[model samples]
Target: MKPKPPTHITVFAKADGAAPTYWECPSCGFLSGDARFLDTEHPCPECGAVGVERRRFPSDRVRRLDERIRSYQKQGDGEIVVILVMTLLETILEDILDRMMDAHGGDLPLRRMIMDSQRSIGVRIGKLFPALAGEEFEEAAAELGYRDFPKHWRTMREARNAFIHDSPFGGPRERLDARMGEDAMVLLDQAYRLFVLLNNRFVADGHTRS
Candidate 1:
């Protein structure tokens, strides 16, 4: 019998204290933080695509923001961390959706019009992303080993909303703590990898356009 695949993958950090290091399979758009997966003979878990070359995500802005968020977290500024991370996550999601729209033949002006109309993250993830990617965002994320991402993201968003807005019902039911802030950080790291995989799948290879 073939040896069992590794259950846990390692995410390596950069020497410059930049973004965490990960690998991308060009052939199948699979993303992995595990260094073992970078071997030339290793096959992509999702598509059986083989390659040794690993690609890095071009995310200078995201990385800079992530560093700042980390600093806030270290200082025990939970509220700031949560707020900033939520904003960052939304921006990243918007970028991915925009790229997906572009791959599906949307021009610059058309893409702007479309995005302007769907400012709600729920609608974007549930309806727009699926319409462009040919799969539900949650399903795609789960397939790529981020099964809890959608739920966690929604929870954080709800918390952020509650904290930001004073409702007559309760005037903000939940308070964001350091734990939640740490969770937000975890999600931030995962988002970069997931979005990169998504871009490679739909945008980089010209799959949707073709």
Candidate 2:
């Protein structure tokens, strides 16, 4: 009826290196270099008032973006490891200080401990998402509505610390399911979310692909 949007469309082009040339769109039948629009769906530049799919670049920009996304994916995995380790360590230290501060009843020491932990987390977050560092942690916390995550963080730290210090947490899960199983999962999950967040930021900034 409406031109039945061709069953399929494909593009061919020549490039160096002696390989067959073809650019293709996986969506509705659209040619690679045809009619100026199959990269993303957008308002048609030519037909005026009608919408069309945009064309993708076999251009340097597209290739570069593809490469960058791969690189970020690998880097994201590495950072996830570092974040879990650091957060766990910081949590243990925070727990110890929290107890001390509660016993002492002086805001100075507790404030200092909090500031230190916040700074450490901020520095690590920047390593993962550099753009986030320019903003204050308070603001970020407010944005996330995570004003009281210290307790959770501390628990993670203590769990990790138990594993490190040859404590009961190290026992085989068949013996006790309480500590090791859940804590390890939580840390892993947190690390993964951090990875996703960073990867998304890189894509959004135009430095990488989705």
Candidate 3:
């Protein structure tokens, strides 16, 4: 039987202002922001190809959106920070998953159709990732040493939804506080690392090794 997904809660540490930096393998397009990844002249873990030049992951467009989020955060607009943070996280998730699918030989139109049909974040985590990755999202996260990430992300998503959409039962969340904004920042920092690990493992290594 498959192991159950983790149900434990997560706590966040204070986040710094700087964003994480990641390097990509030009040969296979694997991305990793972990310092350990860039520390030496290791062969590209994906295609086993040595590289001449590498591009930065989380491209310029993404960096600009991250800047906007930081600006909102600095201005103490917690509500907007929470919302835009979710947007940025979702974008990263979509980008990595698309790359994973591409590595698995999915064509563009098919990938777009799949993404369109399963637009909900819940489905993406619970169903879509597993379908491609051959394991639960929670399982993958735990193995990658971020056991609490999925739980914390789910909580933040709940908070974001409460604030963005009216609930027939509870109306809507009045506002997202600075504490929640702080939590969002913590998750934002973790996202780059977690998704990079995932991309490196599943999108690149998983595909190439198999």
| Best prediction by TM-score | 3
| lDDT value, residue 172 of candidate 2 | 24
Model 1, 71-178: lDDT tens digits are 998899999999999999899899888876765667999999999999999999999988877778888888767889899999999899989998887688567899
- What tens-digit string does per-residue lDDT give for candidate 2 at 58-172? 3354345434433433454433333344444344334333332332343676557654666654354333223332343333333334443434554555544454456554552
- TM-score of every prediction relative to native: 0.73, 0.27, 0.84
The residue-by-residue lDDT of candidate 3 on 1-210, one tens digit each, is 222332211222224575656777766666654444454466655565663466777788898999889998889888988899898999999998898788788899999999999999889989999988888999999997899999999999988998889999878998899988988988998887888777777766645644
| lDDT to native, each model | 0.74, 0.35, 0.78
Question: How much is the lDDT of residue 191 in candidate 1?
Answer: 77
Q: Which segments of model 1 are wrong by more than 4 Å? A: 1-17, 21-58, 207-209
- Higher-lDDT candidate of 1 and 2: 1
Better of 2 and 3 by TM-score: 3
Deviation from truth (RMSD, Å), model 3: 5.5
After superposing candidate 2 on the true structure, give the runs of residues whose Cα lies further than 4 Å from its correct spot.
1-132, 136-154, 166-177, 202-210
Per-residue error for 182 in candidate 3, Å, reads 0.5
Q: By TM-score, is 1 or 3 better?
A: 3
